[model samples]
Target chain A: MFQSTGEIIDGVAKITLKGELDAAASGQFKDTIEKMAEQNPKKVVMFMEELDFMASSGLRVLIFAKQKMGAGVDIHLIGCQEPVLNSLEMSGFHHSVYLQETYSEV
Target chain B: MEALQLPATLDALGPIRDYVSEASKKAGLERKAAYNLKLAIDEIATNVILHGYEEAGLSGEIKISFEMNDEKIVLVLEDRGKPYDSRRHEDPSEADLELPLEERAIGGLGIFLALKGVDGFDYQSENGNNRNVFSMNRPN
Candidate 1:
């Protein structure tokens, strides 16, 4: 199961993702990213504390988010769990995004 | 030993993961090992679904069988839609890992990680089906 919601706050797109992030859910995540990109937000922050699993398809979306948003827009990941963090690290995605222990820490 | 036959689609990934997780645990794999096994299976299954079925425009099924002994566990995935060998990619060098993200190839990274995470991997094609085998050491 998967659930995600997005909102713009102070010109930054904040998307909260929960549940397992398998291939089936990646399309929805990419759609959220596209929707957020349309707002031209200066930054995109993903809240992933509740995310339990992340498949390769989910990592692919992170790549898509980077390409779609361009270099100027920063992407922050907050509160990544061990499994999801391990997936990011395995694919070398940890180097491409900023990881925060908490939203306020960023 | 146990087996599963699922459609070659994204929706089947979750159930596959669940089955692998349960089987790995039953085989005496620790948390980390079980997690790696699940991740490895996900990578290969994603490849099968994307390259095998969707890209080939042929719907098919992926058959998975798991067997465990005192020392190790083996997983075999059989697919009929297309032929792809994940072992074709060479192990990444340190310099390769240092490359800028945009400069790196978009695909194969997942397979690379999956290969590194497991104890053994093999691929073969026979009778119009691609068979991928993965093995991991069982925790003492």
Candidate 2:
């Protein structure tokens, strides 16, 4: 399952993901991003503290998100677990997105 | 694991992964190499459990073996599911992702990732048997 809870705090569109991101979850993920893409947020902050795992399909979805949203939308991955981080790094996604230790309320 | 008739499906994949991870570590393989082994094993196992049986009642044999030499890890994965090479399919193109969500493929990405992640991946179908050889080398 993939979910994105967005709430703008301090002008950043903070999206929190809480679920296993796998092949089964890609559809929901893509739809979530498509909805958010219309908002035209300057920065997209992802809270992954609760995200337990990530698969290649999930990573691909994020790659799609980046491409769909364009360069104006800054994407920040906050509090990513090791498995999620490892997958992104192995897939060369780390270079395409931003990763941070925490959100600090946006 | 042998009694399950096919590649047994477990609630969790930690042990199968741990077993392979430990073996690769003992051989002085890199961490990335170990992880790739685990991923490849999972892809094969998932395919077996999801498609191996005949009408969900019958079962078959799925054999797996491993070896490492000179900074490379080798794995032999075999499943008696309907004779089909899991590696024969092409990965979905970037264009495919542009289509409607409902038309998207499922489970194809894992097989695609496994093929691309491993260093020396090869396959050959023989006499009702499907086999895959996956290998990875230590990172620089």
Candidate 3:
């Protein structure tokens, strides 16, 4: 199962992801990214501490968010588990976003 | 050896991954090895469901089986959806991996990572079935 919740505040968007993010869950994640993009947040942060698994589809959605939010917006992925971190690293997506143990505005 | 058969659909991914986890535990694989095995299986399984079955307008079942011996643990996934050879796809090269997000192509990334994540990966098409075998050496 996959669940995602998001909110935009102070020009920053925060989305919390839980459960597995597989092919079936990518649509939901994409939808959340789309909703968050509409608000034009300057920064996007995804809390992925509870995300147990992520398939290639999830990576695609991250790519989508980057393209949707454009190059100006910074995307931060915080508190990712090792498995998820492995996925990002294997696909070389770790370079595309900021990975942090905690999120603090610069 | 242990085996399971499930429908080739997105919904089966979670259960399929759970089965991998259990097999990894049973085989006493290290955490990183187990995670890599699961990721490898999940990627190919996703391809089988999405490209082999759904995109082809076909429906079938995926059979997953595993064998553990003194040297390694090998997992096999067989599906009748379509004949797919992941090796045929161009793997993302180091240069591709270095490309910026906007320039990177999403296609083939999954199969690339899937092949790279495992210690051994082989694909064979026989008797109208596509079989993907992933194996990892047991840490001594």
Candidate 4:
């Protein structure tokens, strides 16, 4: 099962992701991204420490977020597990977003 | 050797991944190899469900089996959905991987990662069934 929660605080969108992000979960992830995009946050921070697995479909949603949020908004992925990191690196998506072990305001 | 059969649907992906994880453990694969195997199987299984079954307007079961030996562990997935040759698709070039977000396309990344994540990958079609074989060598 996949669960996600998001809230915008001080122009930063904080989202926490848990469980497997497979094809079925990508739609929900996209919905969360869409909602965050509507708020026009200057930065988007995703907490993925609890996220166990991610498939290609999940990567697509990350791509969607980058395009929807535009170049000015920085997306930060925090505490991603090794497997998840591997997925991002293999797809060359690591370069598109900021990966952090902990979230800190820039 | 062990096997499992599940309906070709998105909901089954979690269980399918669990099965691969268990098989990886049984084969005594290291962390990196185990994760790679899991990702490889997940990608092909997703394709079988989404493209081969859902897109083709067909419903079927995907049969997954694995065999372990001294040299390697081999996982095979068989589906009766649309026949597809994953090898037909090309891996993204270095330039493609380096493309900026605006220029990037999501298409074919799954298959590319699937093929690249494993030590060996093979695809075959026989009697209307598409078989995907993924293997990882055992550490000496």
- The numbered model that scores best in DockQ is 4
Interface RMSD of each: 2.0, 7.1, 1.3, 1.2
Question: Candidate 1 chain A: worst 10 consecutive residues by lDDT?
Answer: A87-96
CAPRI class of candidate 1: medium
lDDT of 4 at B8: 91
Candidate 3's residue-wise lDDT over A2-106, tens digit each? 999999989999999999898889999999999999999999999999998888889888988998899889899999998789888877877889999988777
lDDT of 1 by residue, A1-106 (tens): 9988899999999999999887789889999999999999999899999998887677778878888888678889999988778777766666778888888733
**Model 2: lDDT of residue B22:** 68
Using all chains and alpha carbons, the TM-scores for the candidates as numbered come to 0.92, 0.59, 0.96, 0.96
Clashing residue pairs for model 3: none
Better of 2 and 3 by lDDT: 3
- The lDDT per prediction is 0.84, 0.64, 0.89, 0.89
| Evaluation by lDDT, superior candidate among 1 and 4 | 4
Clashing pairs in 4: none
**Candidate 3 on B1-140: residue-level lDDT in tens?**
45889999988898889999999998889998888789889999999999999999999999999998998989999999878988788878898887767676666678877888899989999888999999999888
For residues B1-140, could you state the per-residue lDDT of candidate 1 as single tens digits? Answer: 46899888887888888889888978988887888888889889988998889999999899888988899999998899789888887766766666545555555567877887889999999888899999999878
Cα error, candidate 3, residue B25 (Å): 0.3
